[model samples]
Target: MTARWWQKGVIYQIYPRSFQDMDGDGIGDLKGIARRLDYLAELGIDAIWISPIYPSPMADFGYDVADYRGIDPRFGTLADFDALLAAAHARGMKLLLDFVPNHSSDQHPWFIESRASRTNPKRDWYIWRDAAPGGGPPNNWISDFGGSAWQWDEATGQYYYHAFLKEQPDLNWRNPDLRAAMMDVLRFWLDRGVDGFRIDVLWHMVKAADFPDNPPNPDYRPSMGEMHSLLQLHSTDQPEIHDIAAEMRRLADCYGDRVLIGEIYLPLDRLMHYYGREQAGVHLPFNFQLIEAPWNARGLAQMIAAYEAALPPGGWPNWVLGNHDRPRIAARLGEAQARVATMLLLTLRGTPTLYYGDELGIGHVEIAADRVQDPRELREPGLGLGRDPVRTPMPWDESPNAGFTTGTPWLPLNPDWPMRNVARQAGEPGSPLMLHRRLLALRRTHAALSIGDIRLIDTEGDMLAYERHADGERLLVALNLGHDPQRFVPPRWARGACLLLSTIDDPVAGDGEALMFRPDEGMILAPQDNS
Candidate 1:
């Protein structure tokens, strides 16, 4: 139940390669992130989560890490990363790096030697199996990106498994030696003074012991299918994962104050277990209902209730509206409805994560097939496919390349950059970016907004409302998700509350007729403390 600085802090996720490019090699680098630490500090965020920056071939971007201890030359040297850490700390912000232990790049030396020959000492470091009697994979499992998860290696005359792109091979965590090596990877970064880690695909660390064949899903379809569905019973998300996580918890605890935030998209009830019994597991497991939920009052309210109820008695709750793996919130909720979604994310009873460009209300882009760089898209040409759209560069200015790089960017900038860049929006009072800044500052100023109890208030269609209370302080929040004005009767508790903030262009009296809320509008009201 102890509240650490990170537990109550807002964590901003910056995909460094797409955040900015200092050397103009088109790729975003650590120096670019250093330049933007001020921007993050200005936003009033308490922490920043930088995606993988380790040595890699960019196979799965940086997720297929080639080295666990050093930075890739493409992302700049270890010195550059050290400087970035120093800059972030100087601004009083914590840094959380992404830990991709589920897999490693086949080009990684460990995997190279493991694949070189069966007699290699590190051969058991990766999963390898001989062909069945009929000369095929031992079991059927699908890769998340596309196609079969098993890849035939003629060098070893065996099949190595990958849950994502083939170049990123799944590690054999079943081996103690491999687990120890991965633990060392954690220690290496911890020694570098990283405040924490956002553990990628944490649930997929262990697989079914028997390699059981997963049944086909009855709801299967070709359109934007979950690669997980090809196998009904996931070989991933095994019970053994908890123990692995416990070991990771022990490792993290060795370096005090460092936490492990997990990325597990399971339903709330099941997701709560990742925190482990007796608070011994991951510090926080992400609740991703917003990404996969229907954007409506009923659906969202129900998800909120479920997540709130499922949070462990003393456990912290975390919410994520969107991430690199999904469409931007602006695109999903429509540009006009984006702010309504933002209010819910910021006002909810949790430490919310704002994806890099979401504060600017950036929508998804459409990248042509020939322009696609995602390995998943390249391999599976037509599958409505490609993640390039959401992973575009952040718009920092109106200048060429949107201040992302002097040279062409790794991915094209969103064409709406002229209007959406931070430079233009930073000074605009009505811009979503400024609104986000105000909301974050408000959260920091109000104890009820930061560490408080949540109560979902009943409301009509397209309207979401809730209350956050702590000690004698109480704050009520409501949003109209549509473009047209909507009315709501003030609940008894909110009837006497004073208006604190609103996204509306024109304010309306809280006591007035119907309490109308304009489109994409939200308001925060502080209740009179009668106690």
Candidate 2:
């Protein structure tokens, strides 16, 4: 099988509201992103995945879209978006927009009409059901944000379903008209030259026909969250979702060269189904194993093996370390381990998505109680579910507001921004940002690293090693997850290999037989002949 550009490319995610601000509105805008095209191009990424920029009510931070075809005025005008798209394309970069198909903002005209009366033309556009026998929600469904998933509508005397916030109503995928309208929404963006879409919550698009209550989770724990009390069998990952995914893929196929990336969080076996029986579903199901797996070598090795083993024939893999919703990698893992994590993510056999600000080693910022803006935190406080800490403004330089805005920023910048800003790191050799650039450059130059088949290397004790090979080129990647030095001998076929790259600035010295690796380090080795 041949490979597409997306299959061998690296994607960089940008949260528009925090990336940069050109209008001094305390929020990043499309024009700010446009002005940074050169910076992104120099970062060596092939594509930019911009978080949702559509008109929204700021309820779920743009996830609850009110208008599908228009850009949010806070971000910029439609004309500004067009310019950003053109600028990205001019730099040989692709642009991916976030698409929210599972729900729409309650303020949306479609939802407003749907909830206007029981007999409205769009009454069936959203999921609505009558009260149960006694008088509460229709079923035992729970919202991800918090509380019951059903919101009672006093005017219509019915309850509407919302998998997230009450202000965001779930769309009825069962309705033919609704599906057609949603497909039209995709067309609207594709018509404007959007390279592809990252479909949010793809597995939650459809529910069971009978709307049965979810079974209780046998291993549920209180600290996990309220939604974890149930298995979500009836509310999520229903078999019918595959058909919907395939339908979306078919529509994307019509545009030729456009990709459909589904954001799904499921076990390896179940996640494979999103690839469809004949590879007709989403182009990429978005493998998030790295984000949730244990931060040790053995844990990550097993996860990579399991995921690689679970892919359907002809299905490609993708990976992510952090996103706007999760804690920064530098925060979860220390700075040293985060560097090793970067090597692992890029060296693995898959498309890698880099979160904005991660290249500069940005960690979580402290958000005060009064300054908290995440709806998840507002809904469920004290659970440490707030995402504001990781969504702080990007630090471009050591200036007021970290050069993100002239006015106040929505979220506070990390106190270390003065030394960790991009400008500072860019000027320093062997900085985290420089490491990322070097790794990306290595991938760009080596087919074996970019589109190679990965084979796990058996080893013991605090180390995980793997080999990537393609077109007669081979490379070995080994990581040390321990805090002490460890020795590793290369396989017979890999003997006499020369070091290509190392996470640490020190040279990797070997005693003619085994190589010594410093703590929290990772290295890529290539054959002496190739070197």
Evaluate candidate 1 by giving its C-alpha RMSD to the native, one decimal.
Answer: 1.6
For every candidate, C-alpha RMSD to the true structure in Å: 1.6, 1.1
lDDT score of model 1? Answer: 0.85
User: Candidate 2 lDDT (Cα, whole model)?
Assistant: 0.91
Per-residue lDDT for 1-531 in model 1, tens only? 346887668989998889988897998989999888889999989999999989899898899999989898888999898898988999999999999999999999999999999889998888888776798887878888867788999988899888898899999899999999999989988999999899999988888867877898777777755584665366677878888898889988988988789999776767888989853789889888888887778788888898788777777888899888888998888766888788788888878898999999999898876689988788776776577888999999999989999998888888899889999999899889988898899888887788878899899977888888877788889888777778877678677667788875456654353577777778888867623
- Top candidate on lDDT is 2
Cα lDDT, model 2, residue 138: 94
TM-scores of all predicted structures: 0.97, 0.98
| Candidate 2 clash pair list | none
lDDT of 2 by residue, 1-531 (tens): 367889899999999999999999899999999988899998899999999999999998999999999999999999999999998998999999999999999999999999989999899999989999999999998899878999999988999999999999999999999999999999999999999999999999998888888888899886777888888899999988888888889889999999899999888888999999954899999888877778777887888888888888888999999998888899988888899999999999989999999998887688899999999998888988889988889999988888999999988888898999999999988899999999999999988888999999988788999999988888999999788888988887677798889999878878888888899889999987662
In model 2, how large is the Cα lDDT of residue 426? 94
Q: Which runs in model 1 stand beyond 4 Å of their true positions?
A: 226-229, 232-234, 509-514, 528-531
